[model samples]
Target: MSINVFAGSRKALVASIALAAVLGSVTASSAVLAADALSTASTTVTLSAKINGFTNTDWLNGVWRAAPALSIPASTANNAAFKVGASVRLADGQVRKVTKVYVVGSNLSVFLDGAVVDGNKVGAPNVLSAVTIATATTSPTTSSPTTSSGSTTTVSSGIAYASGINNFTNTDWLNGVWRKSAGFSIPATSASKSAFIVGATVKLADGQLRKVKTVQVVGSNMSVFLDGAAVNGSVVGYPNKLTAVSGSTTETAITAPTQTTLATSGLNNFTNTDWLNGVWRKSAGFSIAATGANQAAFKLGNSVKLADGQVRKITAAYVSGSNMSVYLDGAVLDGNAVGYPKTITAISGTSTSTGTVTSPAPSAPVVSAPAESTAPADTTNGQPRLVGVNLSGAGFGPSVVPGVHGTNYTYPAESYYKKYADLGMKLVRLPFLWERIQPKLNTPLNATELARLKQSLDFAHKHGVKVILDLHNYYRYFGKLIGSSEVPISSFAGVWKQIVQEVVSHPAVEGYGLMNEPYSTNGLWPQAALAAAKAIRTLDSQRWIYVAGDRWSSAYHWPHYNTQLINDPWMRDRKNNLVFEAHMYVDKDFSGNYFDKAEVFDPMIGVNRVKPFVEWLKSNNLRGYIGEHGVPDFSPSAIVATDNLLAYLRQNCIPSTYWAAGPWWGEYALSLDVTSGKARPQLPVLQKHAKTANSCSSIGPL
Candidate 1:
């Protein structure tokens, strides 16, 4: 039988071969007859179970068996086919063609036609194509074969679909953005299947164009994956959704650029303990003071390699009393041992002060300006002194407190408020936990917790003392850090809203303190406090809101918070309705641990260092609160410093609250607990400034 042959493109070759089979007498086309010797040709065959042999002359019985190297089990469970006379493609773009085939264990192995190796083995499964038995004579004619332009896929035993395709290797796919319309259809036909191969890009119904990573075929059905996930549809009936993006379009992962100006002023106002201790990369305008400086260094931007393996941005130079501070990234790094990383080998500029002047010795504090302000009044009878003490132990954690969580609460005796009232105190700062208020995000306050808190408020009211509800969690909820990805600024704001809504109606509640000593990292405190302030104003619009600054709300860090405060929406929306809070402890380390001789005499460690902070507040026409201040009565220095600090607050008309008075303080140094109807040693100093005894009798609740 003469078989008609035609040589041309793949589509033409397939059609001519099929048509010629029906017209058996047709002659070979001139193109086919004059074609070069058959160097390469391939076809497809279904994979089947391996048999022992050629099946005892199965060709006569019309039972076709797999050729050698075709009996191996495939990598996947899906049906597969073989393409004969085609070269197997490897992942590295190398190809090896099979010349001879044989069965190896239920699998078949191919030999290189005649080449002999000890095992006659190349490998299993990496082979590209296979061939099927045909009736035509297996002979080659001489002619130059045509080379195909696009890739040719071969169905061979153990050959997985699109196994070596890499989208990243082709700049055409990776560099250009791709798209597809809604409801695009994917083709399931074999030829179309080859076009929508793995590593191709496809658009989803949501308009997101993602790379196709997974493809599966079972019988006639096909599934294509996008964004590492599969789309829902039958392969053939879906719309043709994918198209190469030609116009300007956005990449899914790339966002529009945003500019971040380096924090210049906030850095100078805040101290970074890390940057201060690190090796100073000093330059012409910046200098690190080994001893005290007569003149302040000129503020200049620089970088510091921290011990924690982070590079920090530093700016600003501050001379606070005897201690000098270098501000970095919105806070001062406090330490003596901080140094530069060894990797930083060079300094870019000289270290010098812009205006050097002779300075006093370390014993004398640098005085700035006197604190002056029209202090807001409190709910007192004919007087406006803020002489109340803090309730220390009730805010302890692990027990549920209304509007808070993670607190093990303690309730002071109802008589303590009366006791403080009897001492002529006019206000109380009631510290509380955040976890017990709203244990879960977006959840309401616990009813029982609210009742307990109301009881405390009633006690304060019964004693004629106004209450300042304090969030004592230090700007955190359990393990969740505010201003972070886990607990965003809105979470803090939302919780405050719940707290304010529940207690805004209470007459004894004078104000809300956002957070106590919010010493947070990442410059998050200002934003977090502002969010909470905004939330509170949404419901209780007219109430006074107190916001604490970063670095434990240190009086030293007041300048930074002042800058943030002026720019805060809360400040802009409600002018003269906000109060800045700061904490002070007169100790050697400023942590209220141990007192030095200068704790009393040296203004830097006591009353003098706060002059700049007070001046800043007064200059901005902003009122503030000494949220927490305490000095131990162990020595005369502590007593003297305590007296001086209170005098400073009273003289400036700044509302102030003593650190704490609780039943559990016992002998704790800073405790001002009243026991046996007698106050702690610090009580006399507190009473000396009471409304009736001082000039603050005219001030009232804010």
Candidate 2:
């Protein structure tokens, strides 16, 4: 924008005449040939307009610098001449002022500020010629701002508590520039928490724009995870304008949907103490923060696994104030450093993928359990079917009962062993100690103890009943009490191998019960137990091995096969030599009993009054056996199904060792007087059941 200033020169006169000739058929460049070219030019000619060889040119790239006529002052005309402020516009898109006025001859040359050609005219090639300035006014200079560098994302806080700000402004207001479609879909299979990316926009419940989240699906869920760093960000009213030419204008914007991010680890966030502590894993699909009404750890609408990866691959997540977060694909190794608001990063392990994720349709609900086989082997007549009992082994006892078992310190007497066979006991249970045999590392079994153990085994052989040797106490325990299954595997396995070697030759010992209730969790217990199984198999192939589950004696399914804990020949069990064990206490550490005293609480049915744990045991390869279960005398319905419980035992055609033979042993330990010779009412039930159990031998299901 500029004001025109010129001197007395022929340039101004020729410019006016050429402006007039562009509207006519006459050539405006005739003045250069016969001093007559002053017409046939565009009405808005630039002050430095170049008349290249003079034909009407296509170089119209300048702005007009004159004010509207409404702002003009009335001035007297002298000999058809008018005086007005001069505002010059050049072909380069720059508009300024021109002061000098000039009139040379019939072929006039234009000048500004009493000077000749202060700026250049750009028309056609070598055709820069102006006639005169007719109506002129003052032009002003104006400008606006625009982005020189591209937009970027920034986190105001640390990664642990990340926030997002896209299309964000400092002022508090709802901006529509950033919003996600109500039913937008992202890549994830299971419920998940997604990481937000920069430069993208998402819509909030308040209709404001936020950071957009791009996610990946991993292991039955989305790989997208949050980087905890969100501090402050929001929707701004407007964007800074552009400078230079005012031709095109655009505003920066970002709109996104409300997504959930989660930190799927650490026990502090949950109040339930019994809940297992571990990474719940971020699966494929969409994940919402704990902010919205439907915020959850998982969010799978239509998730599928990608071609290169396995099923939905989930990862770990961290916390960021209120938002939950998970990082996948592009995540860092330490898992702590992800660029803020960025969705999934690097990834390891397998991935899960599927369709879109949204709030409209919910994902399928999943229950934590191990996969099971479709069918189990049939039990036939006298085929040594799977059967056992939970001894509820006592932690305290006087001298062990003699002659029924091997070196186990706690035992039922030799006479009791005979009684067991008399009443048809097939498997005698004995839960022993972690503090005894290998008390501090390489300790060997004592001679006196070994002698006692042989005496007991001889007695069992004299009668007829298989003796099960259980490594009841893991070496990690300091005393008779149980320690965590988290002890180092090397020490535990070393001791386990020694114990296995000791019992391999014992004819009375039918099997070696591996770690009692080893957790199937992602830990060393299972791995170490499997190692012990390998050692046992290597030492004595004929004997069977028992392995218990993880928490709560979970026997359904064990850990993943990839754990490689089970040594070689894992699938090579032609002997059907493996038995998985479970211990069922009443719900809540002893809740109401499903059946009264005599009735059986078969977990085969659903989980109700009875524990459904036994069915879970069969789900994984291997037979199910109750290592521990009992009824309290306090239970009012003691003898209700004493008949059915006994009948069912017989119908299954499986052997069960009664929990007690000694008058005051085991459950009686806490109640009955040790010196009391009285019998528990359940003894009669066991005797009756044992008598009837043989009936199923001929009428077997198989």
Candidate 3:
């Protein structure tokens, strides 16, 4: 699996937490001060200038640059008259609290809370009105305290105060309540030192009130619980202020929004629309009538105008309840969820006359093989002649490089080779980390790792399975990407040269996959792949060389990123033994994780995604292969999609390998491993399409 795919869900969750902290703050209090009462000094300023630009500083904050640079008081730390935690009103009449105050080369830049709009966290340029700053006053007021009989008197105030409020960093939205993580300090100087009891109410910096639920003080730091999540547009962190409100702690009842089923008919006659909350709905208008079986009007490939007024064809459509959602050309318009149809200006190719249209049945398309003139004379009607599964265990545990052989990561057992070969699978794509094979860049291959790799090749040779040596590194070695000063292209080429020198004569070695999925921001993968291929050619010119494209080698994006490989003269192989490799997945994120059944909403998803790559190969007369593709065994729709995808590949004479079969993938949804002598659900599908022809000789002229 792609590392990016594995970490996609985690990255999203972290972003949600950061967003909540910026939009609102949780209030809880503990301890009280007995010393003289402290009063805070504050100042307010109004500016009539409009915001000319906005820039995002980070996930939780952004800077609003005033037009023509507004002159304001110095915002340095010593000048507490104007600093962070200041509240400001925008020209649009919206109030926001400042998180940072700085000058960008004489232009005042006020950093404030940020919100996500159109799938990105960005600041909107608005007019500036006023900014208010507050500072603790130096002067103090004395207050007398009551004393017990015959005991020394101690000064105390009945009000509670929480100090070190600025140190609270993390926030979470739990049970509809936004809460600050524990470990914040409460100074023991206030009069009512323990007034932060349960059921107490405290007011946050933004003036929003919250009720206390639990209070636990561990030494100086206290963990106090608050009621209710952060309100939208509320600021989280305040520099030096947290005031306890004196009142009864009565909880407010929150009402849930009512769920209503809207109409889905007359969607083809939309006037205006917008994509919001991962669905396309009417921006402003009344709901249309509900769509029944007799009134269905939209099909899979009808062209319609979106909110932006651009016409796009619908690739998939389905109705859930009374709302209908459509996907345009397989594009994930907003996350994985499809768009709910709303009012639009026009929709073409569907008859609205009689209010009756045919809705496409959720079934796989019948794809026929096209005649291939470029195929060799012996090619069997352009059918895919090689099918197999990836033997994936040596690539696990990437964090522990050069780890223990079996405990951290292991190689596929010899029995796997015999078992798969007996099932008519003659190809095996073996994934191994480059760092494990060559521990140090531009250095000799590790003896133990090299020996272990050779043993797998020997097993392949014994079982008559052709092996593709796949370097399962994502264009990096030890966290450093290729083409960087630390890891140059020469180092990448050097490793391939050494690998080829060791395994060139092995009969099972069908090809050398330079890299598994080269995703780099420096745009140097094409050059690095060309250099690696040249290095391997110098050692052995007959073996095929497979070059994977950037962006995880996604088949859907092959034409956009890999067309340069076909046009560049330096990338040409003298022996014509080069093959392009790409990967495809039916899931919405293309991660191949398939955590949800809705990911495979359309049965023809696989065929639609791989069409571009297949067309690119046929049009350019180039040899192409699918290096990785799989579907979860639990989803029947996903299985049908996989079958359709394999059938399309066979028609186009392109081979593919299932994502995996390894001893370590226990309970993995895509694994082909047998459990308790019962075959996995996806195993029969692979067995039905298994082919053993010499793919290299059969696809193109040799």
lDDT on C-alpha atoms for all candidate structures: 0.44, 0.32, 0.53
Per-residue lDDT over 138-199 for candidate 3, one digit per residue giving the tens place of the 0 to 100 score: 32322321111111222222235644353433223222122322112344343324555443
Candidates sorted on TM-score, descending: 3, 1, 2
Which regions of candidate 2 fall more than 4 Å away from where they truly are? 1-381, 385-410, 479-487, 519-522, 554-576, 587-612, 636-674, 693-702
lDDT tens digits, residues 1-702, model 1? 111111002112222332233234201111110001112223233333332122221111111211112223322321123222223322222233332232223333332211111111322222333333222323232122110111112211111232212122121112111111112223346654654443333333233334333343322333343321122332312232343111111221211111122222212122242133332221101223323222222222333333333333333333333323343421122233233222211111211111111111111011110011111236331134556777755565322333222123356677777767657676778887777766677778877777778788767654546788888876677756797787888888988888776665444566799987665446777677777887786655444687776666767657865476567554743233677777766554555444254444454355765665677777766667888777665666667777777667655656778876755444455667633335468788787766333333222111
Candidate 2 lDDT over residue span 376-485, tens digit each: 11111122323433232222221232212222223446666655554444456665554555445546765455554556555554454456666655323553222234
Identify the candidate with maximal TM-score: 3
Q: Which should have the higher TM-score, number 1 or number 2?
A: 1
TM-score of each: 0.44, 0.37, 0.46
Q: What is the lDDT of candidate 2?
A: 0.32
Give RMSD to native, each candidate: 36.4, 39.9, 29.5
* RMSD, candidate 2, Å: 39.9
Model 2: weakest 10-residue lDDT segment is: 26-35
